[model samples]
Target: MSSKHKYLNDWAAYFDETGKVTRFAFRFFREAVKPPYEFRELLKQCYVIGYQSLFLVGLTGFIMGLVFDLQSRPTMIEFGAESFMPGMIGISIVREIGPVITALICAGKIGSSIGAELGSMKVTEQIDAMEVSGTNPFKYLVVTRIMAATLMLPILTIAADGIGLFGSYLIESYKGDVTFKLYINKVINILSFGDMVPSIIKTFFFGFAIGLIGCYKGYNSEKGTAGVGAAANVAVVIASLLVFVLDLIAVLISDIFYEL
Candidate 1:
């Protein structure tokens, strides 16, 4: 194919995929509100996607805080601003890095897992079987997973932020002599409702995007077993991209709120 033709074709395919995902998302909304609520399934997903993933997210957050503080310490010391470390680190983590990093990790772990699981079911005809058996597979599978992710990610982010700040505190205590009480007080003074609420709120969107992309890719898998791997890979790539896009949009919206 010619370069121009190939570019046009790719653009068209992208739009087509976008339209399908949009419709899929709408269908999720429709199915979610009506029905025998899948509370048990949702709780199961929360345990699988949220609680199970906590150790990874918390470990990442701790390392992030430690490294971030270690890297920033020299600069702060040079300017005789070491006392500002806790507050600065807290704000940076809580307002931006914490949620984004946690989401990206979840995107890699949870997104790929969902995609692979559902893709395998698709390839094996289990989803079709469910449909034939009059089970609302979309509701039982997709909606519950999406809702669990959406609700659980903010909680994970909160946990990550706390752990990350504690990591920073450990570093601060080792480097200089700052008590936990003082460090926390400094962080509390610097952090405002504006910094936290928007950050936490945006995480729901991140989780939703991750879950939606995973479900969409898996639910539409083709080419048998090979398609399962492809679905997982594509779900991670797209979900990671969506996290950044959503974060940018969230920042813009938060800026507007901050201005007022």
Candidate 2:
């Protein structure tokens, strides 16, 4: 194909996919509200997507906090501002890094897992079997997962932020002589409700995006085992990208609301 023709084709395909995903998301909303309320399934998903993923998320958060502090130490010390480390690191992590990092980690773990699981079911006709048996697969499968992710991510982000701050405290204690109480006081002094609320709010969107992309990819998967692998890979990629995109939009919205 010619370059121009290929570009046009790709663009058209992109729009087509976007339309389909948008419609799929709408269907989720519609089915979500009119349900028999899959509370058990939702709780299971929360355990799987949130509680199960805590170790990895916490580990990543701790490392991120420690490394961020260490990396910024030289710069702060150069400017004779080493004492500002707690406030600076705390605010950054609480307001942005904590949520974004946690979301990205969940995208990789939870998103890929959902995609692979559902994709396998799709390939094996399990979803179809559910339909034939008069089960609302979309409700039992998609809605519960999406709702669990949406609710659990903010909780995970909160946990991550606390752990990350603790990691920073550990480093500070080792490097200097700061006590946990003093470090926490400094962090609290710098942070406010404004800093936290928006960060937490954005995480819900992150979770929803991750779950939505995973379910969409898996539910529409084709080509048997190969499609399952492809769905898992694509779900992670798209969910991670959506996290950044949603973060940007959240920042813009926060700025506007705060300014008002």
Candidate 3:
């Protein structure tokens, strides 16, 4: 094929992939809302996707806050805004860094794991077996995973925001010589509901994107083991990219509302 033809073909394929994933997410939501709630399966998925991910999320959250505070301190000090460090970092953490970083980490850990597990199931024909046995495999397997992810991610982000702030507190106290009481007051004063609400809301969209892409990639895997690996890799990549895109839109909306 000519170079132009190749480029067109690639673009077509990319659009097709995007559409397929969108349809898959729609199907998952449609099925999830129907009766016969997969309570047990949903709980199991929550354990697998959410509970299992706590340690990694917590560790990353703590480090994110610490590093952000340490790095920001010098910059703020140069501007003689040392007193506002806690407030600035608090707003930054709750509004942008905390949610985006947490979502990316979740995309890497939860997204990749879900993709690999579901892809392996597809490769081993286990998903087919469930379907053959007259089970709604999509509802039971895909729905549960997606729902678990949707619910778990917001909770995880909340925890991460908290942990990250605590980490910032520790670093600021030790490195910046700020008192705990003043730090707490500064943080509380600058961080209004405006900042907190948008951050939390963005996480929901991030979670949905991560789960939907991961499930779509795995459910549609093709080349056996090679496909399984590809699904996991692509799922993380797509989910992480979507996190930033969604974050951008969210910030735009937030800016409009706040008249900023």
Q: Write the per-residue lDDT of candidate 1 for residues 47-85, one digit (tens) a residue.
A: 999999999999999999999999999999999999999
Indicate the worst ten consecutive residues by lDDT in candidate 1.
169-178
List TM-score per model, in order. 0.99, 0.98, 0.96
Q: Per-residue lDDT for 133-248 in model 2, tens only? A: 99999999999999999999999999999999888888899996899999999999999999999999999999999999999999999999999999999999999999999999
Roughly what TM-score does model 2 have, to 2 decimal places?
0.98
lDDT of each: 0.96, 0.95, 0.89
Q: Tell me each candidate's RMSD, in Å, in order.
A: 0.7, 0.9, 1.3
- Candidate number with greatest lDDT: 1
Compared with the true structure, the alpha-carbon lDDT of candidate 2 equals 0.95
Residues 1-260 of candidate 3: C-alpha lDDT, one tens digit per residue:
99999999999999997788878978987998998888999999899878888888888999999998888888888999888888888888888888898899999998998899899999999999999998898999899988888888888888888898889999888877778888889889998988888889888899888888889889889899999999999999999999999999999999999995
| Backbone clash total, candidate 1 | 0
Off by over 4 Å in 3: none
Model 1 residue 44 CA deviation in Å: 0.3
Model 3 vs truth, CA RMSD:
1.3
Runs in model 2 lying further than 4 Å from the true structure: none
